[model samples]
Target: MIDKSDVETNVVVITGAAGLIGKAFVRAVAQTGAIVIAADIDLSAAEVVANDLQDLGKVETAYLDITCPKSVDILIADLMDKHGRIDAVVNNAYPRNANYGRKLEEVTYADFSENMNLHLGGCFLIAQKFCAAFKAQGFGNVVNMSSIYGVIAPRFEVYDGTAMTMPVEYAAIKSAVLHLTKYFAQYFKGTGIRVNAISPGGIFADQPKSFLDAYGSRCAGKGMLDPQDIANTLVFLLSDQSRYITGQNLIVDDGYAL
Candidate 1:
């Protein structure tokens, strides 16, 4: 199939548009000439991103707290009314508390449940509403963001000389998201709806040198990922390029999973 933008009805809604990867996703999709809604909890930040991409394509910003159903409904409904269609949704918004990204011992039962519920529950609600609407409209696509930790066990050695112990809840939440993506793919098999996920490896960030070297040893080349790496794959999944792919968790971890 050719580009979905060829139809002039490609409107992509990306949640968490202010986050690292979220911003990259907006830019990548905007380059394709599709109408992109950079929805996020920080409306001002989203607006800035949309404004920066105005020259590339049609981009707009809106407030959306993916963890809130009413907020999700309001945004989607408004977008459909204004754009006439919402061809795809990238579920990349993650609501985290101040104690987020804590180590295993630092994690509480409450923290674990809260994070998982916020992520997986929000995905369920958003996908439910989007799918129901898409069912009547004829087609839709969803891309959930999982993590490499969701696929393979974390290498505890990488954090040996660093303060970077992966979050316990992160693995559980991402793993749940992977299965949920699969369930929706099967659940909506004949409805022209595609559900897929991206399981990303660690991206390059300011970490201890020891941690980086240790992690690098396990990778094929680069130890960390660039936001563009994930953005490229996201565009493919959202575009007609991957119209036939569904229920797949495509990993973009620089071979860290190997």
Candidate 2:
């Protein structure tokens, strides 16, 4: 049992709060008594997550399209009015399936732009708005989600006697988010707002078996890392436990990168 007083009354805004990692994050922080604003493009999914955690702590569901500036601004303003200050924001929303394992030449420009906008542009806009709020309040945390592919190249694996490759756009956008984390962290230095990132290797929940099989083979036959692994790291970053850490990309890959 977590001590509620330790994290009580903190307001956390989590985008993509309906997905695997996002749901896990909601449960984790709610257990510690933090009020979570579950924001997602999927309003129904967000409502489910919010309802599930309502007994633990206050949760409000909001329909958020991170790709749209007006939508993002409206949500931020509403949260600010209601909560007075946002203690932290977990940017767990991703636009598309970057794990299609398509080759660079096979990936379309539309695919590249969509992924870039969600990962890079979304992070930039959210960080900018959240930092403004944090500046006024004098404290906040921003946790951007990245992938192990952001730090290293994907490995080729032979599956069913055929070689498969990871998509280039996935790697590119994640890599961009990693740097954006550093940029935001540095830009807001001494402002009491910490910006950081979590680069998870692979999370297997709800993924297609074929993709998992190929990825597992590439990872030396290991299972995907648990969502809890990423969630725990996120909680630490959002909590006072990581008050001194910023501009760092924390990897939670269970040695898949090794």
Candidate 3:
């Protein structure tokens, strides 16, 4: 049996809280009485989420640029200082305006490098910092957001007159993140810190209609999995309900891989 009270006062830091999936996670976890720090590159957007959760638990906001080591260090240090201990962290941030829909041939070196840096490098840096804190506190959870593309080939398509395709670089970086999760999980094992990944597929809500319709058609029955679906899974992983699971990737894609 899991005790909700054990986590009631614990602090959870969520990066990319302004993003679709991250916002959902904030809402779900807040209901459990955890103080949530909604961190994002966009402070205004993060503030909106924080305000909405104020009634559930203490909600705070921080501006975090995951690509910068100094930024991550400052945020982590402050959170640890104020809260005394960080119970969990969710690395849900990703580059917003990079070459997302381009193919490998069309992608510039800069584009590929940025994707790798944000997904793999940023995740590594944040995890290392948080693991250090977890070690001191003797308990923590690190949740990395991966994609279905991390484990499978990209399925390209055109929706509502706009072309949509998953890039090779994105897939490559996310794949590396999955392995990184395993590495961190093993390193933190027996130290009370758990590392894991959530690979979401076809999150279309709040997306452009054309993109949603086309992607929806392709996904059909198994195409569009709600952000709430992933959020629920995340809560379980962060909560003691999944205390025994670590170094693993949970795919919540409505069997899209099938």
Top candidate when judged by TM-score against the true structure: 1
Candidates 2 and 3, the one with greater TM-score = 3
Each model's TM-score, in the order given?
0.95, 0.89, 0.90
Candidate 2's residue-wise lDDT over 1-258, tens digit each? 344675677999999899989999988888778888889999999999988878887788899888788998899899888878889999888777554556777777787777777667877888888888888889988999999989987765522344455668778878989999999999999999999999998887666667677667656456587788788888788777678999999988867787
Sequence-dependent TM-score of model 2:
0.89
True-structure lDDT of candidate 3 = 0.84
Instruction: Name the lDDT value of residue 240 in candidate 2.
Output: 73
- What is the lDDT, from 0 to 100, of the residue 67 in candidate 2? 77
- Candidate 2: give the clashing pairs: none
Q: lDDT per residue, candidate 1, 226-250, as tens digits?
A: 8998998898898777889999999
Q: Once superposed on the true structure, which residue ranges of model 2 sit more than 4 Å away at CA? A: 1-4, 97-101, 158-165, 206-222
Residues 1-258 of candidate 3: C-alpha lDDT, one tens digit per residue: 346675677799999899988889888878778888899999999999888778876778999988788998899899878878899999898863456668668988887777777667888888988899889989999999999889888766534365556777778988998999999999989999999999988786566677766666655375678788898888888887788999999998877675
**Cα lDDT, model 3, residue 117:** 75
